[model samples]
Target: MENRRSRRAAAAAVALITALLTLVGALTAPAAAAPPPLPYVHGGQTVPTYSYADAVRESVQVDTHLDSDHDGKPDTVAVDVVRPRTTTRVPVIMEASPYYSCCGRGNESQVKTYDQHGTILSMPLAYDNYFVPRGYAFVAVDLVGTNRSTGCGDVGGPAEIGSVEAVIDWLNGRGTARYRDGRTASPGWTTGRVGMIGKSWDGTLANGVAATGVPGLKTIVPVSGISSWYDYMRLDGVPRATDYPGWLASAVNGRPAGTCDAVQSDLNTAGDDATGDYNDFWAARDYVRDASKVRASVLIAHGLNDQNVFARNFSRWWDALAAHHVPRKLWLHQEGHTDPFDIDRGAWMTMLHRWFDYWLQGIHNGVMSGPKVRVERAPRQWQQQADYPAPGARPVRLGLGAGDGGAGTIDTGRGSGTVTLTDNPNLTETQAVGDPNTARADRAAFLATAFSGTTHLSGTPTVTLRFRSDKPDTELTAKLVDYGTAARDDYLANDLSGIENLATRSCWGESTADDSACYLDTTEIVRTTDYGVLSRGWTDAAHHTGLTRYTPVTPGRWYSITIRLQPQDQLLAAGHHLGLVLSLSDEENTTPSGTGANVTVDLTHSTLSLPVAGATHLGTATTAPRLTGTAPAAPATRSTPTRLLP
Candidate 1:
């Protein structure tokens, strides 16, 4: 009996010890790491599982190295942020812009709204509303000298770029910022990954900031942005407008009057509108020269008919990015100075969501495994291609041959003769190309025979002329026109970026009483015209030597000048003719020199280079016979201006 009781006690003690050990192990074994809060992805995209209506909103002031206003203090820019309510870190999408207070942003011209305590209540566009619910933060920054920021606007100068760079630095925890309540603001909620996006001036800032090779910027989407300020205001040393930089600075400056007057004066003096030359002032704002420093992936969007920013801005930047083998994608549409969201809302949103997911959140969404270029051939008609300049495009050179009257021929073989045309500053492009078959004294016209099949022109065109001017200096204009009756986007209209806003509204994400995610629906403007201008170029005769140097023209001295037209992608159907018109002082596009100098061209020395895709030659050229007495008057049509923006 004693042995049995001792064994039973011993077994009970062992069971008790085993239960205690198991309990201790359960208590100490590092509670199954609460699955780090992360963005949820499904169907190859980040899902909108977070609540947009309850996102946290805040504001901060970032310090910049520049004192553009001469206030003896460093400038500080305002940044408005919206993020998910979670405690975990998230990636950022920033838009640095000067138009927040001056011109507003997006299609509806929505500006930033603030509360009584100076906190941001609403952002300009739908970016915050759409992205915040998807576990991303949206930052709307006011460029220095605009809105609530302190400084003077310098256009695209160093001060502007410095302001944007400072914000990026702060987001990366490399710089300093302060809240409105004077508390130090730290970006502890961010993962230090950022993507910049905007349109117009906002997009321009993206290009500028990305060129700086900032540490945290992972990618950028520049929509209708300028690559070079010199190209924006001038073309090959020809001024587009006088006092443009100063005027633009004054227009966008939101500070007190007279505070930035000195800055405006400096802009006028440094821009050198009188000389129309590329100087140090322009070199500082040229982004193409610094493209090699870009470390971020770029997705560029531009309108093929964008006259305000122009197509060359994107093309030159695209070429520079290609030379460096940078990761890039392109979206080209038929609208003018517009956003892809306004063109194709559903597709743009999908691509943008997937793009951010892949680049910012490190999601394996396969966004980069497709064709690199998407172009809209017509209204609402899109086509994807491997690359631009259409894969197999090659330059086809044609020599100009003088014919009867002012009519001329462009063919493969050179012809011997001289053609003369007197400059008329008052003549418009419409008047110059009117009744092109008959020709006019104010302009010289060259024609190529109708295409036998569909032909594509996918790149920039160059016009080389060997001419002698009667005066010391003169201005010249070259235009490539497509002669056909087809329906096309009417990009020259004065409406909102070639889109008509409808009464019906569409919502993208969650909405609040003060800030709604709904926006007015839009439709593209279309017109069926008899002829359309494919590309236009202008130059000052004195700039024949180089863009930086201006040599006075010697009377009767032959000068060979080359004018490169804007980039284009067009499909010429069967029976469509291509024409080149040469005139002086394009009244529709440039500031007329009013020199009225007569120019004589040597037909044998002049040539036209066209980028034709999949074509060995342009078939043949035939000069139209001289008209009898009076050529038939051109049909009355609406005038199309080359530029529609101020």
Candidate 2:
């Protein structure tokens, strides 16, 4: 009898195994929601980062406390400041942008306070990597609710501000550590100067800390930063409806289990509106509104063709600083957000060194002597400006007619559109065979599509869209395309709509499957910026159909808008073509979405504001220099300054 029962159990086990195997086989394809497991060895600890000569090894990650109101449930914050082998105590420029380090660490998790440390990147190449080896104390702080951080994550609010001040105090108060004695192991800043550097979220925080107007904050580099969240993720002051829900979910879910209770909808556009009266909550956070409060010398970098965040964000910051007569410099490129580190590492390192020396080392390299601005004149060539966005440039309007709108520019308007892609939202192009990786991938369809007859239009393109929606609120997105790539075209970029891929660690982190939208620094580029829907790994096509599009009825109710698809400062030489497509909604990375409009998207007042780089100094920028004969490679070993460690 016992043997019979055992046989029955064994039979059941075999049946279950068979079922699971069948299921897995049926789904052998990629798991859309699954992310790769964390790697055994971190990519860091081997490569040198900006702030360290060797991989840093501290005895234990320290946990700091942010007791803002002194309630027993202390607001938990954690930071590790690696002072290295310095001669004396050092002043610190702390910018905790939560750059992907604290994600998987397991330390101590608590109610109001938590502390963890799993987020190490392709090495400690995050911001801390840049600060640690430069003889300054490099610290990565988890404010309130990230990693094993304690309290509730305030989402870059007052909590971050308080925690930042707290960490500064903690460093100042610590007498010694196992690695170095604070009093004896620091030369500190020779000038007692503290500075901040970061891009994107970190960049925003980098500027935010300065708003407190803290003393000793000598300089700030807000790379790809914006003045306001509304401006960054919304269009016309409307939080992106399609992408906001997923965005809020991604950030909140990153917090410890119980610290945050807000569901995805809680922070959706509706939820945000329910909580606030107007865009007031967003106004207080705008950088321009508080630009006057910042006293640090600033260097602003932006990409002119940045589809993510419009140049308007950086313009606001630059404009505000100019109004206040604040000392600032600007750098513009024609790529996506931050300059791609993997590909543009060498140039970035050079840029970093020049910046740090001018600010930290007090070197007289005449670093800020010129306009201190740089714009990519053309392929592999960049030009300097005393003030960014040089003065010779002005907007020249071009129009398209109701004809075959191939690559040329013509006068356009007085026409109407009735069709809508409330359903179809896939991009128009994909990379051609044998050249899929190039920028030509997005223009899979046409060099020019005829709306009427073939109209010979000239110059760069801009679309002046006069649109209205049925919904009370809406967002309008436009993508400018130039079909056909030369054998060696180097100026195209894959602009990602940040609306979709909000989560999917597979895209943001080191997952097995790769994504295209997340990283968009294609060749023939200059600079980049960040903006709406917010970016992570946007590529989910399903969610795109969730958009709510409206139609226009009344006259003058339309939102008359003009979008600069191509940079005005260029010479359109011959058949190197351009095209513009309108979308009430475009795809996001993981948060893929589409337009739902049945309205008329009249190209009524649309025209290209082309800044023709005619035959002269500006026109010279049109030349795309070919990679010449082989250049000699450096020796196997080379020496870089300690500050340039990463």
Candidate 3:
């Protein structure tokens, strides 16, 4: 009887202890959602189970300088966001642009739209529809002075950079935003990691913001973007395209016509188009100058034939990034002022997807491995390389021989002679390059032996000329052309509209009711030509001293200077001849020199060194043709003979 009573007491005590432990466990359990996965890699690829209609849509008013309305507070930058409806936080992809509310984005010009209840129905491009479903937030910011933001559109000024920084701060819970009813909001759903991507002006903002060394920004993809505002508006101490600052400002600022006049006036005064040299104003806009501040990895895509945002912009930026030891990638194509979406759609999307996923999602996807550069060897034909200015690109000098009449020989022998050309402001590049025999008195041509095998020009060519000018300042233009009988890619003329027929339309990524993920995959158009310009360089003899200062030339003294043409990656077939043309002015691209100077070239001291890939022997002369006269010659019926080197 005593043992039974003791056993019952022990059992009751144990049961009581178990009940107490269960109650304590229930009370101490976590009330918040589970933490994100460690090394968030594999999960980043899994599509999130979330409804687009139920996704969170919000806006933030980031504080910036220069309140155009005389408001007591600084101007507010409008940040529109769309993200998956998930309890767990996710990374963000943002694009800051002055065109979000206006001219739209990409070839189709898609803009942002809002629903009846003030919820965002769609965002520009297909980034939101595609990435939001893959567990990332999409933020679109309307640059100051455009859209709902307040302030003057200071084209790439402090206000623009500040607005971007503020938005980033807010995303990381360091700043503030408000709802329509005045309720405060925060990026509560964001993981604080960010990636920026865009094209043209939008990409320019990416370059600017990344240069700021903003804390949360992890990577940037600037496609066809400018690194220096001065490079865009001017070229080597000469105004580039006319009405640059004024026209560009007007195009970006969609506010009342005169609302941002004060800002416009400031831009005009600072740009100082008459004198094309670096100043304090341009210094403020130069992201390349501030590249040391960049902490984010960079991926740059640019077209070699892009006239708007020249490839030099990206090349310079790439050099700076490499110098700073920042992680970088490049996609140099053979198109003009275009997005990679139309060039190689599938590959572009894949690369971008992997890029963002690896950077933002902590994915160890080996994206940084493999080649760092993808160069277009031919139209839409890409070749991967470990680095740019491709390895083994040795400088091959084509020595200029004495002038035989208006024409000259480009060979290994140093011969004596001089060729003089008068400066004509109205003379066009077409007139100078069409037919060598028809070249005007304003230009001089030098011919090189044809290639025996396929040859590649992989980098910038330096034109070292020993010349004398008749005036204090004169403009000189150098063109490298591939003289051949074939159809040349007319990159500048072909439009991106692809096939206009509806049947040819196809979707990429995901689509929404307001915006289609579809685009027309257009075929590139080609034009037959006797010669195609491979590369070009321009300089003002005065600016040759330095881009920041002008040095006048002596009328009759010989001056030796090197003009480095824009970087290029062109392939010449076996029959193609390498032709070098020197002219007084490049009226087609820049403002006319109008200096009326007669430029004379001293042939013996001049040499052209091109970065030719896989060159063995210097080309041998197979044909010695007579030089064209001062007057235009009759149109030729057959192709001219071109020599080759083995």
Q: How many residue pairs clash in each candidate?
A: 0, 75, 2
Residue lDDT tens for model 2, 1-646? 9999999999999999999999998789665787432221123121222324342333222334544323456564545444445344444555564543333210110112112433222223333445445444445555455544555544445665656555544454432212213223322332356667666666667667776666667778776666666555544323334435334334634464543554333345432532122244455456677778887888777655454555666766776788887777776664545443422445665566566656754555566776657765333456665553445544445443222221122332233222222323443212111121122212211112222221222223445645554443333444444323322112223222111122222111111121111232323422221101111111111112221222223432555555433232222334333344344443331122233433344434544344433222111111121221112111111221111000
Q: For model 1, what is the alpha-carbon lDDT of residue 44? A: 63
Each model's C-alpha lDDT? Answer: 0.84, 0.42, 0.76
RMSD of 2: 26.1
User: Candidate 1, which ten residues in sequence have the lowest lDDT sum?
Assistant: 626-635
Ranking by lDDT: 1, 3, 2
Error of 2 at 471 (Å): 7.9
**Once model 3 is optimally superposed onto the true structure by TM-score, how far is the C-alpha of residue 72 displaced, in angstroms?**
5.5
Candidate closest to the true structure, highest lDDT: 1
**Sorted by TM-score, highest first, which candidate order results?**
1, 3, 2
Who is ahead in TM-score, 1 or 2?
1
Across residues 211-260, which tens digit of lDDT does each residue of candidate 1 receive? 88989999999999999998888888887777788888888888988999
Q: What is the TM-score of each candidate against the true structure?
A: 0.91, 0.60, 0.87
Q: What is candidate 3's CA lDDT for residue 211? A: 96
